[model samples]
Structures are given as C-alpha cells and as structure tokens.
Target: MLNNKRRFSLMTTNSHSSSQKVGTINGTKVNEMHAVEAPLSGAADEAFVTSLRGRFVEGRFVYRQIFAIRSYEIGPDKTATMETLMNFLQETALNHVTSSGIGGDGFGATREMSLRKLIWVVTRIQVQVQRYSRWGDEIEIDTWVDAAGKNGMRRDWIIRDHYTKEIITRATSTWVIMNRETRRLSKIPGEVKKELVPFYLNRIAVASEEKDCEKLDKLTDDETSERIRSGLAPRWNDMDANQHVNNVKYIGWILETVPIEVLEDFNMTSMTLEFRRECRQSNLLESITIPTTRVIGESNNSINRKPHLQYTHMLRLQDDRIDVVRARTEWHFKQKLQ
Candidate 1:
C-alpha cells in the first residue's frame, strides 16, 4: 500500500546546490536538481521532464498532479490548447493506476485484466473548460474513479490553478473493458473488479446538472450544415501502444470540418465525445460538422448570457463511411473573454 501521508511539492533548480529535495513518497525522498542539469533524452526532453510532478492523496483514492505548462503545449493565444489539457488528464489517470500497485504491463490494466487480455477503452467523455492555463503556469489536477452502472467505470477530474487554486476545468468519462484478441467489449471480470473496488471514490468532478443531460446526437453526413473535410489520414505518430489511433487525435479531426468563422469568433467552452469505433492508421477518414443556433441546455431567461453556438460533429471512414466517433461542442463568444 502507498503511504497515505504523501504530499505535493514544487521543485526548483538551484544553481548553488548540487541537489534539492523534491518530495516524499512511501517514506522515500526524491530529488530532481540533477535532472534539471542532465536532462532526459528520447521521447521526452528536459522541458517535458520538468512539467510532471504528481502524488496520491485523500487516502490514496484520489490522484493529484501538478503540470508546468510548456511552450509546446500552448497555442498562438499563449494558452494551453484543449488537446493539451486532455493529454494531461490521460497521463494523470494512467499514473494513478501505476501508483496504486495494481497495474499490469498493459496501460492501466490490472493483473487479472492483463492475464485475461482485457484493456480499458473509453466510451464517452465530456470536458468543460472555464479557463485555459497559460504557458509557464502551473496547474494542479485531481482525478478519481467511481463505479458506473454495474460493469462500467467512471473517471472524473478537476483542474485548478496551482497558485490561486481557482478552478479551470472539469471533466468526466465512462470506460469499459475490451478483449484484445477478440476485439470485443467485455464485462468487468470478478478478479479485476476486486482489484479496483478498493480505490473507487464516490465523488464526482462534473455534476450531472451542469451537463446537457441529453444524449449526444449521432450526426450523419446529410445532417451537416454543408461543411465537410475529407481525405484525412492518420500519421504513424498518431497510433498509441494499443495499435489504434489515439482518442485525442479524433478531436482534432472533428474540428477540421468546423467553419473557420466559428473558430475565430467563439471559444469552445465544453465538448462531449462518444467513441463508437476504433480507427487504424490504414483508414482514410472524413470530418463533418452541423451548425445549430439552438443551445441544448441553456435557458432563454438566463441573465448575463453571452452569445453561444453549438455544433454536432462526426468522423468516419472515407471509403466505407463507418462512423468512428460522434461529438457535440458548445462555444461562447470571444468577447466574453475580452
């Protein structure tokens, strides 16, 4: 079992000292002063190395991590992109499993799951961004998992400014197991369930009342508002360890069909995505978007409301036209930010 008393630390490089204490985990001290000088090689460099500092908290049920926003993670607006924030959520969730002592070699798989050739796959995810973190900013993220229905798992995350402690984002997702060999959905095995039950939390980061509450509409090509982008193909780097296109890549493709005018005038406040099928590197895809004037959950009488636009998106194979993902996004006027 991990030490429940572990605390977070923000480490800095000191020119005067050879090494400095970063933090403690399971009663062992960690130092990162030398790492700053030597730097990491290969997939991650020095800049990426300094960004990740994480630990377990709340009796080890919740995982908290502090990430320094790197220059590469930010966009032209000098703020972290939606894709960057999603990547942080993914990395934190995987680290949580690794620290729990129940993880197997497979990404986030338990021992029983690895033996059974089962891997977790997300079914749906929703993210609400109240504010975007800027480059050089440090943001703290807390994530926890709970039971979803009888066999599925629900994960939630809350991101805040590390210094001000102001909430920046909230996200929630649902996942289920899939058999690796058969490529089919599977129920939570008894042994795997036993491994996870101890770490499950009853907390929710994104409230249901705050969500649209209505199901995400499955958009078809015919329903799109005359905006479509075709001939999209996955690059080699887009594939994950599981040999499928990474989920975050789908978000980029979905936005490809969105009208440039909408992208310029509005900022995406929330996005809901439903993963229906996996895409491979060999598959060619098309993106479609449907513009809608009516906001799904907003009230007409709401006070101080900013102009909002909603969009429905679809990504599918270009040849067979098989749906890979369906999504909905809500955007608010950029003037609100000004």
Candidate 2:
C-alpha cells in the first residue's frame, strides 16, 4: 500500500490541493491528483511572518513537499543527482531564520514602510539534475528568501532525504510581487522587513565531470561562419508525454556537432545551459557550443591539456527565437586525448 501524507502550510489553512496527489497504482497512472482545501496552520499574516522572520535570523524552515520532478534534473546521467549535491545549500538556507526585529517581509509580503507593498510570486525556476531519486524516497524540502528586486523578492530551495539528509535536488527561483489591485510590481511594506538581511549564493556550482572548464564568452569559435548540417529529423520516437521534443533529446542534438573523435574521446562530465525556449517536433534543430580552445579560467589539466574540459551547450530549432517553446540543456565534456 502507498501511504501518502501531505504537508500543511501554516497560512491559508487550506486542504491539500489536487495537484499534490500524483501517484501510480497497479501500473495505472493517475493524471491529476486532488487535495482538499486545508486550513491555515495559523493566522495567515502571523504565520507568514514567523516563517520568514525565522529564516532571516536562523535560516531554518519546516520542509514542505512540492511536486516531484517526473524527469531527471541532470541532462546526462542518473548516477549523480541534483539532490545529493545541493542538500547542503538547501538544508542550510531552510534551517536558518528568526524574527528578531523589523525588516522587509520575509516570506511573501513586503514591508510597506521598509520596502514597499507587494507579494512575492515565483517568476522563474531552473534545475539541473545528474540523477533522479528512486521511488519511496520521501524528499525533504525548504527555501530562503533570495532577494527583493524592483517590485518583488526571490527564493531558492532544494530536495533531500528526510533522515539521511542527502541532497537529491537543487533549484533557484525568481519571484515577484505586484500591487494587490493593479497587478503591477510593487514595493514591500515596512512591518514585513526582517531585522536581518538576506544573503546571496556566491556562485552557481555544477556537478562537473571535466578537469578544466570554460565560460560561454570565450568558448565560441566563429559561430557566424559555421554552416551546420542537419543529421536526422524528429520522428515519433523523439516526442515526450508533453507532445514536444523531449528535453534531454536536445543534448543529443549538440552531440551531433561534436566530432566523433571528440565525442568518443571525452564523455560528458559536467555542463550548464539556459532554456530561453522550447522546440516542437515540427522543427529541424540546430546545435551550438563554445569551442574548447576558446575556454579560459581552467588551467591545463594533466594528459597534455585538461584531460577533459567541462562544457555548456544548447539546442534549438531554426528561427529559434520565433519557434522556441521551452528548451534548454547542459552537458560536460571529457578530453578524449586523456
């Protein structure tokens, strides 16, 4: 029997939402799981305040379960996962918070006096996964208020084991708050401010498989002069449940451009790419990458020169800006010579 328990939010006192009940039984898949409107764990305002205030001071939080990642977060392999690498970051951020004094609203609301009037809504979210968690691993999750930008704030979170405390997933999300009536970006109010200030992640870390890596700025080699040839067109095999080009399949597109000797020499080890848009099966795709020769920051690794270089690549359809729907990929490169 599958025992599914839902996390309760102190605010709203609403019941579990239908969206939270996704699960399978006897080989039968249930599309949309439903939950009742739960009650607020406490007064919405006070509870919200306590949640943020604590994070601001101590950086602690009661983990809540959101939706599961149906797909692996990492693009290349499943042996390594977003969960294990980021347990430290997510766990640390969620566990430190306190309501000491006055500052910006910690959770969602803004300080009308300290900042401006607004409610933070997650605007963008991105995740890279090396592996996916096996069934039965109930993930622990939490987040920190990342920032209060022009009219809203941002937060970051992660997923990990409830007991072992191993990270299984990592994520960063941007949030925005708008005026209650106008639906426009607004400043937070004063009472919502935290006496303590929020902090930023110094760097974006990727699970790398290469010895030396390069950045996008210097990685490119005369892309404007390149005339890439199309290999295979999309077939039914390339479509996913979403009825579009499967996300990981985009990595295969980039792999096509790499010389077979290069692909064979260095297996992918680590990568980072942004999905400015997605491609449908209808489009003929294009592969793009920053050449290794253009790489900087990394010193020559053993095996002559950087046994394997870390990499970042992207896949897109022709007229990418016009046709892209939701697409992005990251890949690591191994030096074949090594």
Candidate 3:
C-alpha cells in the first residue's frame, strides 16, 4: 500500500512532485465515476410541471419539472459570476419540487416519509456545463430512485430546455442517512431498502484532468491522508433545477471540511472542479472521503477565490489510476487560521 502522504524530489525539471496512496478502504472506484448521457432532450421542454411522477411504494415517488431560462453568461456577463450562475442554475434546477426548498427529507416531509428524527446531507455533487443556461428559457427537471437506505440512498436528475427540448445538464448523486441525535450514518431497514431496489444504481460519475504541477506542490505535508467527516446538511435553499443537490453543492463539502474559523480566514477566489460523476435524487451523500489539500499565496484576487485567496483544496478518489474529479480550489487570506 502506498503511503497516503508522499514526498517528491524538487527536481530541476518544470514539474512538481506528489505522493499518493494507490487505493481506498471501501472499494470506492473514484476514477470510474463521471460523465452522463441524456436521451438528448432539446432546450424547449423545461418548465414547472409537477404532474409527472410514479408512486413506487407508499411513501416513495419521483419529482420532475423544468426551468424556463437560457444561457448563463460565463466569465463576466455584466450580471453574473460563474459562482453566481452555478448557484443560480442549481437553485433553478431545484424549484420544480412540490416540497419547500430541496433534497430528500424536505421532499420527504412533503411526501410524508416521517423519519422525524432523521435528516438529509449532501456529500458530493459533480456538474458538467457543456453549455450554460440563459434567461427567458424554460427547463425541465426529472428526478427519481426506486429505493431508500438506512443512512443514504441514490437519486438521479436531468435538466432540459423547453423551447429547444435540448438537455441542458444531467447529474447523479450519492447521499447517506444520519440519526438526528447521534448524527451518525445508519443502515436502512431491509423492508425499506427492498421496496426501492427497482431503481438500479447507475454506473458512476468520473472526471478527467491534467492539473498543472503547481497543484501538486500546493499540498501541505499534513494533508497527506485527509478525510472529510461531516458537514452542514443540504438545506431547503440548497436545491437546484432537478430538485436535487446542485453542482455548487460540491463547494459546501469542500469548505465543510475546514473549520468555520479557517474558512472565514480565506475568501474563495478561484475554484476549478470538473465533474467526472453525477448524483441521483434522494441520495443523502455520506462524504466518507479523504482528499489532498494544497494551498498557495497569490498577490491579488484574479479568479473566483478572489483577493487574498489563501487556501487551496485538492480532493481525489483514492484509486490506483488517477482520481476522477480533482478539485483545485483557491481562497484568499483575510487572516491566518488561529
């Protein structure tokens, strides 16, 4: 087994060195997850329609709808930031639900799951914006999963534009269930799980990247075997078009690993994460993940992790091959972590 943390030779060449372990404990195939295919819906079918759904079991069901917007201007749109667009697209995706806000429980309460002591958490979310969405457009979102888990379940979603009937975006997600009091992952009952087994697990979400050497050099020595434990749950407001956790939801997991005080010390200026995977609907991701952390100093705010960006985050799927999604996030420092 390779060490989780590694040291590299600061050679005379133009590349930086990095050390990584070959695999993970639970057989999580990180690189094997990413990319999704829509039956190719056009940009004209997305709209706020809640009339499409099938009640699998007594309490289990599907949620579907569409957003009526078009092209979200990337870079500088005079009215949006990629971050703002990311957050907007996600929220827009989530507006379809008959439930307030988004995610499983909020949607669950509306469906009367009545697991009163349980709550839902979004572990990880990956998004691929082949093209951005625009205003004055209508989008459709489809969500469903055949079953439930003790601590989590899987959920799938798709976003289609109405006027053109083109698929704007698609994604899958993993989530876990938690005890309200203990806040620990629990196993779903057999009866409950068996009820939704019809919804087969999708392949997986995988991402590709050729991160520069600078990213490797940014990791701190102690960041070798970093594992993110828990984070704030996905709130009603955290939902997007398909009524599932949004891509920007991944950032929550990124900073959720850092203490509040530490997060406050830096302003996220630049965040570059490509989605190699998609998450399903009603899936409360557990986030039992460990990634490498890298940090660098910048003179001024140039990207999203603008001015004083202090910290950088690099997360990977502990695998023999390279990980699927290698996120490199930059945060500027307002103050050092105390």
lDDT of each: 0.81, 0.42, 0.41
TM-score of each model, in listed order: 0.82, 0.38, 0.41
The lowest-lDDT stretch of 10 consecutive residues in candidate 2 is: 1-10
**All candidates in order of TM-score, best leading:** 1, 3, 2
Candidate 2 lDDT by residue in tens digits, 2-81: 11233332222243444343244345654443333343445654444444233332332233433333344433333323
Candidate 1 lDDT over residue span 82-104, tens digit each = 89998999999998898889999
Among these predictions, the greatest TM-score belongs to 1
Lowest summed lDDT window (length 10), candidate 3: 1-10
Ordering by lDDT: 1, 2, 3
**In candidate 1, which residue pairs clash?**
none
Clashes of each: 0, 78, 91
lDDT value, residue 334 of candidate 3: 39
